[model samples]
Target chain A: MTDLLRTPLYGLHLELGGKMVPFTGYDMPVQFAGIMAEHQHTREKAGLFDVSHMGQVILRAESYQAVAGAFERLVPMNVLGLGEGRQRYGLFTNEQGGVLDDLMFANRGDHLFVVVNAACKEADIARMRAALEPDISVTYIEDRALLALQGPAAVDVLAAINPAAGEMKFMDVATLDLNGAQCWVSRSGYTGEDGYEISVPADQAVDLARALLAHDDVMPIGLGARDSLRLEAGLCLYGHDMDEDTLPAEAGLVWAIQKARRAGGEREGGFPGAQAVLEQIASGAARKRVGLRPEGRAPMREGVELFATSEGGEAIGKITSGGFGPTVGGPVAMGYVPVDLAKADTTVFGELRGKRMPLSVTSLPFVAANFKR
Target chain B: MKYTEEHEWLLPEGDLIVVGITAHAAEQLGDVVFVELPEVGTEVTKDEDVVVIESVKAASDILAPLDGEIVEVNEALTENPGLVNEDATGGGWFFKMKVSDAAPMDDYMDEAAYNKFIG
Candidate 1:
């Protein structure tokens, strides 16, 4: 508590009656009005999130092609083929075919812009510097603050200030002006909502956030709502959902690996763990992540062991991320299970305390995504 | 009304003492999503965890304030758990217990003392 860092909007959060809690060494707002209220507000309206804790980086080389080519060596995604002004989800893999970290990278024409999880930022920066340094410089953008304006009304709220926001399609990244601040805006977010993530100068972050929050439809959302929103969206939370030992195939993230980087595509097998990852892709992983819907109202939170039978049997899997999904109106969870039990409608059991409660294997995105095409 | 260190409030009425969490406890717990009440006829001892209360953030237990037998529990909590957040002291009451010995109620703190204890 003594050494925890604070975002530029830390004071603003307290001013709005936010409950501050420690998150990844930073003191962040866990909730403002209330978790349930803020969550419902974000789904019904617009939510302003201070994501300044996340790492923003710039990877620059002589050309975008050079940087993309260098970055392609570390990730499984098709980085070299990424179009300028567009962003794509990516992952860094290890030699064991496990994921290092999941991130979003945008081809900014002049350089590539990367946003990584706050917990993995330091290691990610070190990894990039070691792998693509000197020739391709990895610059951590510390002077900027990131804010995500999410939900259905997020577009109109942001567009009212910068009309260009309305023109941007999902995954589009561009440099736009918002309330006199030059911001790197992306039409993508973790919440599966049609929204924009704006990167602004640290000094101007508070003003821009205040400007967006001034709209009647916009409310200040904290990390608590942010987690619930993403959980309902079927999005993975880095360390909880996938980690250094979890393969992309097992985590069900193979779709992000474009055809060009797969087994027989244009640039086949250059990334770390390409062999193991491709092998799993060709056949199938032993265990796979699946959506779990507990039959009862009680949430089967993270670390709750799952069983094959309701009453007995050895632990088959473990819930990775679980909580009451506000929009789903019930408990939603994600966990790994044997491939046979990973399919939707399969009946599984989660052990709550001493009882084995029934849970149905379900399709993800407990609530449908509201992303704009 | 008497209060315990756990933030539970007890209001004596005849032989039964109504039990519920204070507004401060409810507020700290955030939004209550589910409540698992003990059986009405179950005998309870002081400090025994009886009610299982789950909010969006975490799960907590409501302990028995004194040795008693649970006579009645508010069934409304099963359908609308938010009642605990709306009116913790009134409609949000957990259960009514007939105390085996009402003398222990004297050791509990009053409203003013409980308020100071929280501070």
Candidate 2:
């Protein structure tokens, strides 16, 4: 087998007894204590995650507005309206009505910084470089390592380390000196809880992780818990809930598209595949991504076909992502089903092995989000 | 103790052999959330899947080894499945089955060989 890439926190993850596994070509930690325990720890106290494998790119230009307009051409989100020090979720759609990847972009008052999924980073960077001008440089921050401190105690733990972290609000980003290294800290994360994503210099990543783990409430978590936490938060896993054939509206990411890009808006359908995406927004998506809560103890899994009922029922949809949600105390999954079946508490059936189990189409986010306002 | 390459452990307990996953398998599987096993009295063949273990992230199938009919199962796992995580090979045994006949167990490993295989 080919060797997997290791993150900057590789040594530390080993030291903290992280169960390393191959994830998206990276030899990443899947769990430390355990998936359920680490998941519970993040929900109740604080969890420190090494997300250095994610792609962090800095879009440098003469001004933030210049890059914002160029960026708005790639995704459906209203990048031009984003204020300074503000971050917004965006999607890169292809020429066809499909989502290429989901990303987080921040207006740093001077330039734009975007973080995309680790697996799609190189492709995303290549696409941006080909589409933008030479002066509008897109540089991937290869020297930086990202860490996420999430949960109820994340804020207090961060503020204790850097007093400036206390001043930031949700979706706020600021470049501050964390310890001795210059770092970009954002008051946002994938977990439903209030958290911060800190982009620190690669050389000092170990020190930052050590500092966060020192807090009594903070425990080192791994990818296993991260998946469960994000699922409960109703966030989409790029390749799972969305893909090259999945549209933004169909993936339940319509909120990411501002009114400016919708039909009858000021700047209608300016991004790639605008015609199809805008039309879907106006008429509504045929198949929408919705949360599914399986009834009973058996947790459903991905690729399990969905049926109308247990008794020779018609096929409706298939589960894209399914797992046991620690917080939800049962099986929670996300899939694209017909819009008629996407309503609240619409009972569906998940075909597992040979038997079919009733799976209800609950709303997104099995657990209520606790994002800091 | 006989170990399968799939990480299952079959302990020779006289005629009623007990089956469970190895500790290495449990650690790799992470936390076991739910386990669905075949009902007692169901006939099974050697190396056939008879139990399904669900972790928080993925599901794993536990295969039967030299099996005939399932006699008993670890019912405690239905409510407290974490037992597999706590003690995978001991009290966390999945089920007990009456062996039709011990097949040519040449492919399976002993405890010492299994340890080296995992490493």
Candidate 3:
């Protein structure tokens, strides 16, 4: 096994008696107090996550607009309309319009800040470098650490440290002085809740994390709860729900692609697989992503085969991510199936442990999102 | 009472041996949420996976310490499963089994030795 990477807050995690496990090549805490408690705490109160392992990349150029235009050509998003101090969730696709990774892009005052998943950071950087215009430069901010403070009480707790933070709306960004340290705070998160993603200097990460935990409503949450929380919120985990073989259209992320990028548009940004993506968008994709609600208490996990009732019970899809949604109080799953079977309220079957469990194809996001917007 | 190296404890109860996870194992597992016990009369061999336990984070297998036929299971665990987390070595007793052979008893460590082994 490869040696696990340590984050800036590794010592703090150890000090808190965190149970460390290998996650995305990093020694991350799977739980602290307990998984169910931590998961519930985040939903009811607030939870601090040491997400320093996520990669931070700075897109620099002479002007912000120039870099934004160049970035729009690479990813399928409305970057041109993004104002200063705003962040947008988007995806980087391959030649076949398949998503390489999903990431958050923020238009900082001078540079564009991009956060990619830790496991796919290296590949995402390479793709950005290859796709970015010659004049636009890209720099990986490895010296920085990312922290996420999420839950219902996130706003109140975060405001205690950074007073101005409460003013930022969802997807908005602001460079603030956090306890005398320069930090970029974004009103966004992976969990379907109102939260903030803070990028701080590597040295001061532990200090900020400590201050956040000092609040009564804030507690240290681990990767275990984080996965369940995101899963309950119906968020797509990169490697689990999306990969190079999965197209954004099929992944139910067509909204991320701006109308201008569609076929027969007056303005066109020549990104990879534009022809295929536009065709899929115009005619509707063959297969589409859908949420599944399995009938029983047993959690349906990844790799389980999905059978289509419409196709005479023929297996047509497979689960990409599945688990017990703590907040939803049942089992929820996401998978790709034929377009006809991907409609909401459609009945399907998931073969779990040799038994065919009845499932319903529902709309994306099993639970209501609590984003600040 | 004796303990296996894998941190399972076996208590002598008449002709049957009561089995449960050790305190050390429960502490390591954090919080127990669900327990999957084998059916009564199921035959099991030493070191065989006879029961499965799930915590909020991950699932774990409970290995049988001796060859036996399952006689009784802790049905209470199905509801108040947290018993395993609160008192793993005591009230968390998973099942009772009639020993098929007494030879494997020699492999189990005594309380003092098992404590030292865990430490």
Candidate 4:
């Protein structure tokens, strides 16, 4: 605990009565009001999140095409084709067709701005430096703090501070001035809502967060609500849902790999695990990540064994991430199941405390995405 | 009110004792989302897991404080689990039970001792 790092908003979190907990070596706020209330608040109005723990990096080179082409070798995404001022989700794949880490990268004109998960930031940065450095500069933006303001009312609240924010569409990134601070703003978020993730200077983060929170529609949301919101949105948490051994196709993240990166496309079979990933893309994966709705109110949390039958002979798979989804008003979960049982409305059993409970296999995103697109 | 080390509170009422979690336990558990209660008239042993309470963060088992038969269970918690977080002591009581031994009640902590123990 003594060695835990504190974010830029640590003092502000304590002032706001946030329950601080150790998350990825950082003493972060797990909740302020409560998980359930914060969850509902973000869905209805706006919620401000202090996400400074995530690593922000800038890759620079002679030109945008040069940097994009270098980055395309590490991941299976069409980085070259990504439009300027647009963000795309990407995965850093290993040689075994597994994900090392998942990230969001945007083409910031002359350079690329990337954000990776807190738990994997160090390794991700090291990997990027080793792979792309000397040619394309990988600079970790440690002086900035990232804040995500998300919900249906996010645009209205942010537009009041910076009217230009309203003009940006989903996934569009721009440099905006908020409260005298030049912020790297993106009209996107992890909650599947129309919102913005503002990267502000560390010193100005509190002012920006306070300014946003001053709005009646915007509340201070902690990591607890953030996790629930992402889960309800069917977004995968880096380590929880996919890891070093989890393949993109198996984790339902093949969509992130554009057609150009697939077989027969212009730039195909050049990524780390292109052979296996392309094979899975063409032939289909044996197992798939599917949404699970527990029959009862009890949440079938991670590590709970899943079976094909109530009286099963052997466990088929296990839940990756699961908990009470506040927006759904019940337990929602995601886990790997055989492709045969991954169909919607299919019934599977999760063994909880020695009893087999039925769970219905459903499509992703229990709550519909409210993105402005 | 007699309190157990597990953060359970027992209120003596004739042959039956009203059982519920303390406010400290409720706060520790965060927002209670689901509560699974044992059936009425079910026999329970001391230190045995009787009720299952799940908050948004995690799930925890409420151990039986004394050897008893569950005379009545809190049905309201089944509909709205937040009642436990709202009123943990009064209307949020978990169940009423008839214990086989009243001697154990004296061994448990009193209000003062429980507060000190939590502190």
User: Which stretches of model 2 miss by more than 4 angstroms?
Assistant: B1-6, B10-15, B100-119
Q: Least lDDT summed over 10 consecutive residues: which range in candidate 4 chain A?
A: A1-10
Better of 1 and 2 by lDDT: 1
Report the number of the highest-DockQ candidate: 4
Per residue, candidate 3 scores C-alpha lDDT tens digits across A3-27 of 9999999999999989999988999
Ranking by DockQ: 4, 1, 2, 3
User: Evaluated on chain B only, what are the TM-scores of all the candidate structures, in order?
Assistant: 0.98, 0.93, 0.95, 0.97
Worst 10-residue stretch by lDDT in candidate 1 chain A?
A: A304-313
lDDT (0-100) at residue A251 of candidate 4? 93
What lDDT score is found at residue A41 in candidate 3?
A: 94
Better of 2 and 4 by lDDT: 4
Candidate 2 per-residue lDDT, tens place, A1-373, comes to: 8999988999999999888889989999988888889999999999999999999999989999999988888999888899899999999999997999999999999899999999899999999999986969999899989999999999899888788988899999998777677889999999898999999999999998888898899999999899989999999999988999998889878889999888877888889999998888888999999899999888887798998778796888899888999998988899888988889989999988888999888887888989878
Question: Candidate 1's residue-wise lDDT over B36-76, tens digit each?
Answer: 89998999999999999989998898899999899999999
Every candidate's DockQ is 0.80, 0.79, 0.41, 0.85
TM-score of chain A of each: 0.99, 0.98, 0.96, 0.99
* lDDT tens digits, residue span A1-373, model 4: 3699988889999999999999999999999999999999999999999999999999999999999999999999999999999999999999988999999999989999999999999999999999997999999999999999999999999999989999999999999999999999999999977899999999999998899999999899999899889999999998889998889999999889999999989999798988988898889999999999999999889999999998947888899999999989999999999999999999999998889999999999999999998
The TM-score measured for candidate 1 stands at 0.99
Query: Can you write out model 4's per-residue Cα lDDT over B1-119, one digit (the tens) per residue?
Result: 99999999999998899999999999999999999999998999999999999999999999999999999999999899999999999888999999879899999999999999999
What's the lDDT for residue B25 in model 2?
Answer: 93
Candidate 3 pairs with clashing backbones: none
